[model samples]
Target: MVNLEGKGGMKREGQRSLLEKAIEIILFVGALSSIIIVFLIIAYMSLEAYPALNLDFLLGWFWDPKKEMFGIFQIIVSTLYVGVGAILITTAIGVPTAIFLAEFCPRNVRNVIKPSIELLVGIPTIVLGFFGLMVVIPFIRDNFGGWGTSVLAGWMILAIMSLPHVISISEDALRAVPNSYKEAALALGATRWQTVKKVLLPYAKTGILASVLLALGRVMGETMAVTMVIGNPRVAWIPTSILDRAKVLTSTILLDWSYVEIPSMHYHSLFGIGLVLFFIVALIDVTATYMVKRGVIK
Candidate 1:
């Protein structure tokens, strides 16, 4: 009977090993497939956009469909402007909120605040856009004495939209810091503020930067919300002020995509803009990964 039991246990172990191997193979294949799809998308975009790549095409400011001329310089400028502004605002609001939640807030308050922030992440972008249009736009117009649909409105909306992501990521980074570090600092007679500023902040700097980069990418790629608030304008250059109407790449694409004729240069130009946006997001991801890895090494 003991021999029979030992034989059954060996068989069970063998089956478990086989199942593990199968699961590994499946995961490996899925990862490979994902990588292949990404490469294919990049190749396709490059092929479509290559024809539209010329000095005149890039440098010209006109986007006339009749003339088949389209330059995205203004759109690119607006995207950068709004994206940077949004990132700055989100960082300002989110970093402090994250620090407070992670280090200062009571456990009950932290629980409530953390769940609320996570819930914000699940809110639909279109809904956020509509909210901005109805509430934020009117508030801005009434208080600031400008058109409701302006770059500033777009920036503020995008900042709010990105806040959850920035705060969550930053909070995670802060929470990941070993309690021992704080304890050691306290033992050394450092005040809470000093310990947070000198020890915690420096230790979490890379993660914080990574979160900011991720927020930047989100602000850059966000379409529906930004489109609703950006006050799309057919301008030859980026607007000089926050109150001025502007056109971002995503907004331009959303506005023009349906009307653009198939196989036309205008359509191709949109694809080219998409390619550029993709690269910008990709660059942010790569930079964030590098910063995280460098921090790990340090």
Candidate 2:
């Protein structure tokens, strides 16, 4: 009977080992598939975009397919303007909300509020764009002035879109700091706010920056909402201020792609624009990773 029981235990261990190995193989394959897909996309875009992928297309100020002009410098600048502004607003509001939720909120309130904030992510960008057009645009026009569909409107909408990501990730980061650090700070005669300011925040800075990076990516890549509110300038227009109407690269691609024939210069140039966006996002990710590694961000 002892021999029988030992044999059964050995069989169970063998089964568990096989199951674990299978799971590991599945996860590794999944990760590898993602890497493969990204590379494939890059290769495809590069192939299609090579004809129009020169410095003249990137740095020229005009972008009229009719005139055979496909410069994206101004569009790129406007894209940066809206993206940076949105991130600034998102970080300002989201980091504070995260701090409150992580360190100061009552448990009951936090439970109710945290999920509600995250729920905002499910709200469709089209709906947000419509809301901006109807409400935010009118408000901006009536009070702040401008065409209403301006960079400021784009900034405001994207910030709202990005807020959920920042708050959720940043709150998690702050909460992830060891509780022992909080305890130590308190024991050292630090007030709750001081402990949060000097200990919790500093310790979780890396996580907060990660959240910001994610939010920046979201802001830069967003399409419908920004397209609707950013005035979608069809010419070579650069924003002089937050109130100026301007074009962004995504909107230009989105608005123009439907009209262009496949294999046309316009179509190839659109792919070139996409490639530039890809490179921009990649550069941002690489820079942030390097900064974190070098202790520049932390």
Candidate 3:
């Protein structure tokens, strides 16, 4: 006996199975393509930069391309210095604001403030750079005394630029914590503050840390804003003080790339600088992912 209904059902199931396999193949291809693209970029940059990369390239302190002085030690140091300073400032301010928004703010007020913070993220970086150039630089020079464009200026601009990322990510982490944990703490006679301190923060620390890492990457890679306000010292030197003029790696590349002959060592060296930055940001991302995965148990 031919069962027409069973045949029809089998046909539908076969069709659905084929569709599922197609979707899986598409996703697999997408993932493979991304990995392949990344490798291609790294390979291209490495080949281009190989001629200029060496111990001297990594450790030399001066960077005058005309004379082929391509030591980027000071530039690397300044990049780290400004990035660390910005991360510190952003983490300090952003984490607390995130906590308040997640745990304490009234709904209406949270609505207003969170959107405003997100909006700040949308403002063009060039506009921020111009603002720092026109206003922040002069204010710093008048009040704090060095060249208006200083490591301090870079820190301030980067910190502002990084704040929205830290706050939004940190707040989501906090909010994602199981509400039952909070309720449980309160039922056990812990105060609200204690619950937040002892329970919420520990649970959310991984997310908060991830946010800071993301901000660090953003600050390190910022070009125009840091370039505008960082003094871009004529002679690259490790900044000894916050008020000292300094030039970071991104600024160096941005300032010099256009002027360098495409086939020259100077041009290759700039790509090397980019390669170094790529490794740094990749390390941060990997570390963040590892820590967050490990932290899931905690």
Best by lDDT: 3
Residue range 235-275, candidate 1, lDDT tens digits: 44588988888888888888888788878788788888889
The lDDT-based order of candidates, best leading, equals: 3, 2, 1
Q: In every candidate, how many clashes are there?
A: 0, 0, 0
Better of 1 and 3 by lDDT: 3
TM-score of each: 0.88, 0.86, 0.89
Model 1: per-residue Cα lDDT at residue 51: 77
lDDT of 2 at 213: 85
List all candidate RMSDs to the true structure. 3.5, 4.2, 3.2
List the candidates ranked by TM-score, beginning with the highest.
Answer: 3, 1, 2
Q: Top TM-score: which candidate number? A: 3
Worst 10 residues of 3 by lDDT: 1-10
Q: Which ten residues in a row have the lowest lDDT in candidate 2?
A: 289-298
Question: Would you list the C-alpha lDDT of every candidate in the order shown?
Answer: 0.86, 0.88, 0.90
Model 2, residue pairs in steric clash: none
